[model samples]
Target: MAKRPQQSLHRPNDPAMLLLTSLASGPKHGYALLKDVEEFAGVTLSPGTLYGAITRLEELGLIEPLESVERRRPYRITTSGLTALREVTREMGRLAKISATRLRLSGEFA
Candidate 1:
């Protein structure tokens, strides 16, 4: 039997994805997004990293800046971002199901 390549557990270069996902619920300022993402992912993001993610997501049409006269501009997820989030969530669900089945089988054998 051929061995399958090892899968990466970490999401590579996914800060933008994470930011978009967070924004899907509603609009949020930069600082708010950073705080929420840190709480959700358990990772402290530097300003550079957070800003870069926001810029990239904006460029990709995944998010857009909301109406604001303040320096702290809030952003909202676009329809495209919602669609992408839905697809990613579906994939995550599939992976979780597969892992659950494997773990249950292993526990039974043990």
Candidate 2:
């Protein structure tokens, strides 16, 4: 069976993309991010997975920590993070549109 080019955007998805997308709305702590991601993506991320992404994002300067007195440290997306997120989603949208058009032209779309 033929697979859609758009399917590449799913499975083994980028944690950075999910994290950056979450931060797109506003700042959020680790727990908040977990909840938001689950709510939207229907995927539960382990603490390790979440922190691993968080560490990488920090290293890339895509996210920054906010001052927190409690154990829970909140983070906000940096300008660069927003830019990356926008570019990625825009590309995904473009690919989806292209795939849909092709499917329609082939009379495969229902």
Candidate 3:
């Protein structure tokens, strides 16, 4: 089957993109995704929130479950998910740069 395309922009600050981006590296289950996000981005997510995001992403065709040996299902990033990750990362970088410039000008953290 053909892979879905990446997204150009995230759905308005939705945190799911971060989860999808991390999964782009490989397949991971819901709990794994949560731990990875916390380790990589320092973002702690509740189980309910993570499941909700996963469900939404699955519905959107950005991600899907991969076959697994464990009870928990594993998920991988689809083509569309990769695109979304790229877009989200680019936008996040832009926002960070802008924040840094503003901070520097204000001598807040110089």
Candidate 4:
């Protein structure tokens, strides 16, 4: 048997993906975001981790907070953030097609 060369692939684990993708649908507060992400991605980000990413995204103009009625604040993706998400998803889509093709050729997929 011959060993197949491994191809480097862009994974969807980038820290901002969760928040950005979630906000792509609509705005959400921290707790709502945490629940939504967990429900959708099955990953639980600690408060510190989530806040850290939130702060960085805000600094980069990728996300902004919405006016809130109470303590919890909601956030929406900025135009720049949507652009970034589109690019990332496009790349992921290309990789997915490539992976599917490779798997089919290798007889690993039906």
Candidate 5:
């Protein structure tokens, strides 16, 4: 059997991307992450969804947990995470430009 290709982690609406974007500003605990993402992205994430993405991001070495404070564990984006976020951001910008151009050509954008 041929080796399977790895799936990309970043998507426009991906929880992982949201988490990474939130952590880009600073370290945050789970609840803080939830609030920041909701405020900035207008997307609410359940505890299960947030932790699930956190696990995957940590496994990929994109984020790392900081010392727990009063039992709340905080996480910070690693250098690799910053790089990944930058790459994903650039890709999204390119896609957005294409989408805007197509929409304008179709008279769907003013």
Candidate 6:
């Protein structure tokens, strides 16, 4: 038997997914990440929530820390992180398409 491919364990709105999406643009430190996530996702993450997600992502090898600059440590998404993000993005697109189709059928969307 062949081994099946691993599926992404992230949900579109989860903190980990949000962080990965933000990092997709570029590397950012914790504070910058918090601001960017808020600006884009309209979701505000407290310091504890933000750092906790960062630590989990780092441990999963999805992200890596860069050299600290002026006391702020930045993080960049790893190759695995990019792969995971792409997977999740595709999944979200599919879900959105299905939702739109259903809504349209119900005359709820134009």
Task: Tell me which residue pairs clash in candidate 3.
Answer: 4-80, 5-80, 6-83, 7-83, 7-84
- The count of backbone overlaps in candidate 5 is 0
lDDT winner, 5 or 6 = 5
Candidate 1 versus the native: TM-score?
0.78
Per-residue lDDT over 1-110 for candidate 6, one digit per residue giving the tens place of the 0 to 100 score: 53211243446668888999999999999999999999999999988989988988888788999999999999999998888788778877777778989777535433
TM-score of each: 0.78, 0.81, 0.75, 0.82, 0.87, 0.85
lDDT of 5 by residue, 51-101 (tens): 999998898888999999999999999998888888888878787778889
Error of 3 at 61 (Å): 0.9
Worst 10 residues of 3 by lDDT: 3-12
Top-scoring candidate (lDDT): 5
- Evaluated at residue 78, the lDDT of candidate 2 is 93
RMSD for each of the candidates: 7.5, 7.2, 5.1, 8.5, 3.7, 3.9
- Tens-digit lDDT track for model 3 on 1-110? 54343442344345586677678889999888888888887888898878988887888788988887668899998887777777767777777778888777535423
lDDT of 2 by residue, 1-110 (tens): 74332232242367767888889899999999999999988878899999998997887777899988488889999987777666668777777678879777534432
Candidates in order have lDDT scores of: 0.72, 0.78, 0.75, 0.78, 0.85, 0.83
List, residue by residue over 45-65, the lDDT tens digit for candidate 1.
789989987886777677889
lDDT tens readout by residue for model 4, 31-108:
998998898898898999899889878877789999995988999999988877887788777777788797775354
Greater-TM-score candidate between 1 and 4: 4
- Model 4 is weakest, by summed lDDT over 10 consecutive residues, at 2-11
* 10 residues in a row with least lDDT, candidate 2: 3-12
lDDT score, candidate 2, position 64: 97
Which residue runs does candidate 1 get wrong by more than 4 Å? 1-13, 105-110
